[model samples]
Target: MAAAMESGELSEVCYPQDNTSCRAPKQPPGQAMVIYFLLSSISLITTALNLFVIFTISYFRQLHTPTNLLLLSLSVSDLLVGVFLMPVEIIYIEVCWLLGDVACTLYYVADYIITSASVANMVLISVDRYMAICKPLSYLYYITNKTVHVVVSLSWLCSMAYRLLLLHDHLRKPGRSNSCIGECVVVISKMAGIVDLVFTFVLPILVILVLYVNVFVAAMTQVRRMHSHVDAIQSLRMVKKRELKAARTLGIVVAVFLICFCPYYSPTVAGKETLVDAATAAFEIWLTHFNSCLNPIIYALFYPWFRKCIKLIVTLQIFKPGSRDAKII
Candidate 1:
């Protein structure tokens, strides 16, 4: 029995020499290999897709509208998720936290900041669509490029500050929640969890829902007006149609964001303290990151300009002179 116990300890421990080391979860070799392959593929694809989005919007002068600027900010955050967070998470699934507690804390800090910024960008997109649809006459004046730049900057700054405060305990004492070496975990108290839920998830989602409801109603009204007034000016009808289409596309993005994020925060809603670890929270973490990959695909499906940009990018035609001025829309 003693020999068997020794064998088990040797096999299960993250470090056999360190008796206090964390136990590693057991999995078949084949299964572990397959899981690693699938996760690596997702990380690579996410990085590549967001890169395409970032470049597409930035390179094309015609695509420099306020709405695309918001998308650009979102893609940047998603790109960070793909480049940094996903890879770290993939490693965390099967390996010990070798980079030490400081790195672990910093990794999560970056994760939260990027995630908060992404949510903020989504809210801004909803606002932009709301103005364009519900108050079209003043949209051009209110949602200009300069205004968008200022708002995007403020969102990022606020996200960073907010996350720093929320995770201050972890920052002050790295690895405070770890029970053993080789483990990285964070424990959020009930109070902090509730605050995070209310500020990050509940309020943003409520705002998005309310604005979209109004936007939808106003869009339907405009559609009815266009149909009823057959003598409406052709240009005016076309503009309204374009605005309605943009709202529909952006609404899909917001809906997907909600679906991906809801399960992650459901624990707080259920009156549980938020405990984050690689093993238990893996599904929620990956689901949130997966949204980054889906956004570019969504754009490719709904925006002809995105498909055209992809073609030009693949064919190397973007390098040609005056490609920026090409009629993509």
Candidate 2:
């Protein structure tokens, strides 16, 4: 475990004893073991919940709305990561990517595809909400069923194209490339790195923020205009809650990208060798897994219906106890 952490597979922080100058908490083996246990649980729980969300939504026709469609897309992305990415991470923790190059490529591409698609979905959702709140008059036309399908399809297509470029340039080569034998296999090209950040992290985040900021501002303005909505106060408050929750979700996602991916890769992309060293590497992977792990918690907290559904599913009242599927509304 210490060896894995030291290899930058976890985060960039060294064990407290290794770097005396480090101000980080000294993780006792016992405490570290607990963290591992909790994180492992989180990975499994988040993944299962994400899959359930996707399955449940698909399992019910009444829940098929455009907004829910975007949510489904996000859930699918998380589901892929939880099933495909997290398990590999667990393996990497136990052993380096002993998988062959082809297998590694598949896993790497799967992670990239899902993560990139997640970013795109967030941006798409922000735009959807922005139009719904800011331009309600045309939202029905602007965000039609056909449009939703196109947008969602385009999101996946673009992410796939972006990843293929990375795969072609990076993963094709092994030891000579920026990546070690396995892992993300990020190539050692500054331009490629910059492009990746721009497309995957920077641009998506900027778009999400701009659209959601407009949405939030529009919501506030609309709220103020409801000066005499005395009978509608409860409904208006509910609207505000949903809008605020959406904004918070977007913010948390962008924050996760920055904290997890940007710092971890930026220094390496910039040829800062030590940043990819023991201390930072350990922190990066830990935070990266955390990004996938926290989405369900955020959804369960902010989404009332999701919370209720989770409760029902857990209690075995929503589906047969030993069944492979759920029946959530």
Candidate 3:
């Protein structure tokens, strides 16, 4: 990986180069192109659905809250990645990169900035949920809407700052339209990977783990106090159920990110720091696209109000203005 990187093969660890605009190997013909088109269609449809849901939720004044607002931001970022970026990437992978260097620089910065922001938003949301579930009394003090705004704004700013290191060269400028460049290298610099691991992955997971642990402890304490009057087993069961619900949702989100992203970081996981081939790059692109699609299902099932909206859209005739059954909570 290092040698290929030294040869100016792949871009840096942040992968600042636009894959769609880079000169990748000619894709083998047949089943590959067919699969790529299908995947592209699925990505586009999912992005559209996410945009629709996000806009609908935002349009309703009453549904606005910190948690949902964070989700709105994530959906917007993911949708942009899916709608504007991934289609070109899918085509590039199935054929050849046709977009020029200048276009690539624009797309690269735009894509990673948004991707980085999505990670930041998730970390903030996890921290918010942790406070809400565990430190109920302190939650309001720690997690006001103003706090959310500050954290989210800072997250984007921080991500953009990380991205700026890549833009300090000819790689980021609007150059001659058709300048044929060599293959972009794999962005290595274990240092950047480590920082990403800690801030984007480790800290948020720790917050989630600690928050859930505290909630369970608090619930058990309450259950013990009620044991003489009520069935202790029943109280324990109820507490356990809610704990599992929150844990599963947050765990799934974190786990998906780790699985999709971790292998690219080190030897212990995948035995290399670079993508194996064009196939791996294609897979990585689609896996990231799939990640964006998952939040809708997560939101609809995990949040009561979002579930209400989905139920309204599915069960009742939503087109009818007088259908009270379609009302959202």
Candidate 4:
């Protein structure tokens, strides 16, 4: 065993002098290569996909509706997750964190803020769809661009505040809970885990589900009354069609969000303390981040506008003059 350890083939310690220091996991040659490749590929794909969303919505003048603005906010968060968080996470797999405890705490801070904001954006989208479908007449007056901007700003601000409070102790005393040197870890109490699960997961999901059900009912009713008005029938029908389509598309988005987020928060929901560690963090974090990549795909599947935008973007037609003025809707 001593000979094998001396050979440097089994485990590698960060500090040779301190036998109690954390040892980096020994990854088999092939497994390490494959894992690294997969992680790098995911990071690239997530960045590209969310970037496409951000550019498409930001560039197109016609796409500057209240709904797309909320999507723009979401895409921004997803893009940051891919660009900043995923690369660090990939490096964290086999390597010990060289960054000090303060950096580690800040890293998790960024993660929580981004993740919470993404969830809040989903809630906003669901509410938007609900208002459009269920209260069509008042939708324009209530869900204006100004209001949407305010909501998005508040969502981000609240997420940051909530995360700061949740991680207050960790921020105050970095690495106070570490078991060994060179290991990055944060421990949230079971009570805090429960609170996070409720506020971040349960309440938001409830709101989304309830609002979506009402939206569905209203959409079906609108479909039935399509021929009721004779004077403004065509205009009303056109608006209703748009709203219904948006509801369906965003319903898919909500479904995807729930599927991705549930597994990540499962451990917390199980009445256990949430341990942010290398062992089980990757599966949950990557699974959640993968939803960012999937969102654009969901849009492509359901929104014709997204498909058109992709065509223009990929063909470099977006750079041509008057591309922004192109009719997308």
Candidate 5:
């Protein structure tokens, strides 16, 4: 029995001689297969959906609005989450990290950058919608394509910089948290975790909440104003209706973003240590990745252009000449 236990331990350890080595967590055959299928499905779905959005926005000239540009940035981040991060996570589920410590650090860095960009995109969307609904006349002047490009570029650059700062210790000394050979774990200090929670979750969410509330109020005011602007009442009503619909759609997106992200950060909110590992963090990690799959579905439900583009894409009609000028909207 003692020999059998020793053999099992040796199999799990990346380096048998090292006392301070990570042990790979094992799953039963049945559970492993189920998890493999579930995770792969999510990864594939996220990739495909986000890919569709990327192609649609990039190919169609008419879809190049400030709002769709923000969506394009978001879809790119979501695509990275699926194409790069999710597959590594799925592989990590079954075995020890055969990759070196540098790889481990890079993996975490990529994860942090992608997820941070996703959160930033959501905040941008909220701000865009607020501008469109609350200050329609000034929105065109203030929220032009050039400004949107700058905002999206800054969002990504900031996320990369912020995450680099946040994970500086791990990047500087990879495997600092690893006590075993096969383990890939990073323990964030309480102060750092709180800062992460604030920037990634709390602050962005508060911004979204505040902007959305104002958007709703403005939309309501537009609906209730029956006597103002007698000459342009009909045109004003049409514009307000369009803005209201957009606000509602974007509101749903923000709500889903919060739902998917909140639980992932609950431990921090509860003042618990933040530990990243295959075993403890898998559920939270996948829950957040699942949001990428949901975003395109939300677009399909709310945006007519997305549905039209999807049909063209599936039918391979997007391959034809002049498809860039296709009147999708």
Candidate 6:
């Protein structure tokens, strides 16, 4: 028995009758159950939290603003990650790709589109906060709800187009990258990987960092100026404080996103082609998806409005008439 195991004779094939099928990894039954429970828990929590965020912003009229609109777009993308991407990944953790090659290709296409949309939404949020902080005078003029709506629509459209183009090869020839019958893999060439890294990760992160730095400086300057104006209008002071606090909260969201995604792109950063195979890239893939779970948690911790919204949601208060007009912020 020991010799058979060592000689690969005891290895499990994804398809017992198919000689060319991929070998399934050996996982203890007890360990598999534990992993399934943990991953399923993450998926449930992520879906529930992002749903709250979506409902809070969408249902409350008072929460409808350019910034909240950007957040709403973000929540939608994160919700998709929780609902769709994470569950698929959990399946990949312990199973062969039995869904066929075309399905595998389509799955990755959706994954890329959702991820790109999430990053685009983060960029939009940073731009919104920067305008509110550094360009306050013209913020309302430039960052209206209509404008945000258009921008968010364009972001999603662009994400779809970009991902489709990026994965055109895979779309053209499903299973081209897979080495075995039951394997689902996408091998990105070095050049394509570099381009993806630059647009999706490097450029967006740099823009976010630069915008937040300017926002931080401007916020500090405004705080000092308001303090020196001992007779500043009370309402004006309150508005400034609110904007500053928002910037800080969104900064945390961006920071957490960066932390979660950096490791996933580390191979690309090191000049390697990005090979995305569920069997081999489980840790990095799950880490990035975990960001979806963290975003709503950050909001719940930092935003009082979110906590209030949660209370209303849990107690079924949102179904009440006039709840839409309730003060959320």
Give the number of the best model, judged by TM-score.
1
lDDT of 4: 0.88
Clashes of 2: 16
Candidate 2 lDDT, tens digit per residue, 177-280?
32333333433356666677677777777887788778778877877777658576878666666756766665675566556666556664565432222222
Write down the lDDT that model 5 would get: 0.89
Off-target runs (Cα >4 Å) in candidate 5 are: 1-9, 17-19, 226-232
As a whole number from 0 to 100, the lDDT of residue 2 in candidate 2 is 82
Candidate 6's residue-wise lDDT over 86-173, tens digit each?
A: 9988888788889999999999999999999999999999999999989988997888999999999999999999999999999999
List clashing residue pairs in candidate 6.
Answer: none
Tens-digit per-residue lDDT, 181-252, candidate 5: 777888888889999999999999899999999999888877778457656688778777877887798789
Q: What is the per-residue lDDT of model 4 for residues 1-329, given as tens digits with 9 covering 90 to 100? A: 88976858334876656766788856898999999999899899989989989889999999999999999999999899899988988888889878978998899889999999999999999999988888766987888999999999999999999999999999999986678877888888888889899999999999999999999898888777876765668888888888888888888988988999888778787877778866557787788888888888888888999999999888999889999999999
Clashes of each: 0, 16, 12, 0, 6, 0
Please tell me which model should have the higher lDDT, number 2 or number 5: 5
What CA RMSD would candidate 1 show? Answer: 1.7
Q: Quote each prediction's TM-score.
A: 0.96, 0.75, 0.72, 0.94, 0.94, 0.95
Least accurate stretch of 10 residues (summed lDDT) in model 6?
4-13
- Arrange candidates by TM-score, descending: 1, 6, 4, 5, 2, 3
Q: Which residue pairs clash within candidate 5?
A: 20-179, 21-179, 21-180, 21-181, 22-180, 22-181
lDDT of residue 323 for candidate 4 = 95
lDDT of each: 0.91, 0.65, 0.61, 0.88, 0.89, 0.90
